[model samples]
Target chain A: MSRTLSNPPSVELLSAVSTFLINDIAPQVNGQSAFHIKVACNILNIVAREIENGADLNESVCEALSNILSDQKTGSDEAQDLQSLKAELSEVIKNDQIKNNAELLDALKMLTLKQLAIDNPKYSGYHQALKSNER
Target chain B: MNAPTDTLIDNSLSGYLERLQTCCRKHFGSQVEVQNLSKLSGGASAETRRFILSDPNKRSSSAVILRTSSIQQGAEFSTSISKDCEAQIQKLCRSKGVPVPEIYFCLEEDDQLGEGYAMSCVEGETIPPKILRKDQYATARENMTDQCAQILANIHKIKPNDTTISLEDQSPLIQLEKLEQLYRQYNQLSPIFELAFKFLYKNAPKKHEITLVHGDFRNGNLVVNEQGIKSVLDWELCHWGDPIEDLGWLCVNAWCFGSELPVGGFGSMDALLERYSYYSGQQVDLEQVKYWQLFGTLRWGIICLFQLNCFLTGLNRSLELAAIGRRVSEVEIDLINLMEAL
Candidate 1:
């Protein structure tokens, strides 16, 4: 109960503050300050969402990375952080090793799209990709 | 906390307008009064001030725009050219009948106001959403793609010798290398960006034809009116390079503003290419354009990351810069879509 109590409460607080800023405070300001405050509210909303779903997203990214890099020696590093996994994947890409590998390509595309899904779900390509899957 | 060093400079609007009045007195024999000075938004480094100048004796007033970089202490990424060179480029483009603001004068360093220049302000809607959707700009929106192509063709037609200012040519491959180095300098690994870099390297095009590239020819950068594109603004990124670079950069998905249209949220790529080839008398190469589009997507993605770096490294540190960090993913998704299509 204690573990579950901490995270959602903070996310809820951020959501309330972000909404208040957007709906209430934003209309009272004008010009550059108004635009900036709107951006600030958007940032808070993104942070709130990230707080709610960050752990699951990270685990999904790790699983995707592990599946893609299964052939490499560093693939077995189960304890590798997200940064290390990214570094390993980038090094592999830089060396021209992943060419013509359909599985790795799909893995990379899915992983990047997952990031975009979190960062900007409204992105055109993300919606297009979703539509294609449905078709 | 210490304030930014450049902000300490005299930024008082009245004081700067007085200096502009002194400059105007030299241009026009009679004393002129500056009226209605308002700072336009965007341009973190370059300051765009719109004002009107009137002589007491003469009943008429001219709308003039003054751009100043007095506060930009040092060059950050993207803003690589000087104001003097920008003036020269605009002057040359004006001579060639390219839709550009007429250059008045470049503010000298000795005049006490740090480097900047002034030009006759052309009236038009520069906002993307208005240009894309509003009834006032509907006609301009319809003709934007064709005019954009034709204007770019005319811009690329300018020879290096046409302008007195010596311009550096940044080829597509060289530009990619510089961008990759900047990415590495950030010291953070992005597998998505690395994939894009690798793809670009593998598909790098040979220089099609060396010409003046309107480096930042995109939606927000163009001034459009009811007729069509009134003028092109922001010559800071102008350089000599492959002409298709401009065409490719224009069609980049980032310029689309959530619209399905590939060419600046107004028209189709086929229409752009058709118009461009007709205007420039050069054949369109679809594959090369695609490569540059991919390259442009990656380049824009890196720029976002670079701005985030500017925020994280405490170099600029604004909410706008921090907000731009989120846009890197849009480019990433766009790049992946391009890759899958290829």
Candidate 2:
């Protein structure tokens, strides 16, 4: 990839704006406006994290999905993308086609953990799951 | 009660005030003034407005809350009971020693206020963060588990046959089917939800004693004071189901609000079940509660998706709703953890 002319990277720029909203603007607001400002800051942070790690995480998710669905016969040849693979997995699960498959469960867990890593790493469930994984 | 400031009562709200004044007169049987009529935030299924109803002749005023259905013609997405039924349920619960706001009147179609009810506004802090963390509510945090258990017991004592209002019978499998249908309507793929559905199906417990479940009974729906929970609010999602569902739904991690304690961030599951067993006169099966906890997790995830759809479809373009879309992952992780425990 060719280097684009940029002093501050996208992640850094987002973090700077989020800091401005939280440190400077949030203290001045109250009630619903204050709450919305907090949410706005959170959204900015999520965007920054996604920009920094989303592609790599999604690539891992794709690999896990492929490992889980490799042996299972897909419905059609067109169902090869990430979205289709996920939809296929959902369908199979709903139909009880894949029951008590340890590999499938592990894959799903990894996929959800990766998603939570980007969406909300601070969520209590994420931390609990991480602790349980370590154990 | 103080009257609303001039700036608080904008020009757009004058018509609402006039109509509310008329409604107050009919209910109070006197010329009552509706002051400080302001909309309360955070309810998605219904509109809640707080106001001071003053009878000029008596020179006395009291805080009153008006709740009306927010559902419009093309936006029938809520699974809540009717506003009239909700009011009746509250009245019934109050009669059964449950701490709920006193219902004053249910709005009729003739009132032109749509479907709603007026009730006495119970004064207390309803925010979960305040109730869980504030020093004033430290006692409340201590007593909440028992208080909630007692309230749930009282609420569950009311049978469907006891009320004139029609309540849906949502057994475990029936509720799961409805949830799956609702999720399918969104046309979104969520493998974690699917896995949850599968787990719930495989582990579906035998139908226990069917009783009225406060479908949305959780932290945010409670009003707490220094002593403890003063009133239980938001009975819009009440239905007939397994009594344990209430206990399980209360333990959902999302309602914990970043707190480690499971039961609404105030107490442990053992304490809740112990208190509930004493009040309800039956030993609750912990395993059953776990099943519903998993169900509640998936239910919250689907609701987050529903909110995101509302934002995506332009029905409600709220920053809060857009942010809630990202919260589905939190529920996903919670589901994974709960399933692992199972």
Model 1, span B1-342: residue lDDT tens: 001112122346557767777787777755688777666632556777777888778877999988777465643677557888888888888888898999888887666666888899998777786688888887888888889888988998987776667788888788988999999988777877888898788778765688888898998888888878999988888898888888888888887878899888899989999999999999988887888888888888888888889888888788888888888778877887787777
Residue B77, model 1: Cα distance from true site in angstroms: 0.8
lDDT of 1 at A89: 82
lDDT of 1: 0.79
Model 2 gets an lDDT of 0.83
lDDT of each: 0.79, 0.83
How many clashes would you count in candidate 1? 0
RMSD per candidate (Å) reads 3.7, 3.4
lDDT for B125 in candidate 2 is 81
TM-score of each: 0.93, 0.93
Model 1's CAPRI class?
Answer: medium
Q: How well is each residue in B71-93 modelled by candidate 2, as lDDT tens digits?
A: 44435444789898999888888
**How does candidate 1 fare on TM-score?**
0.93
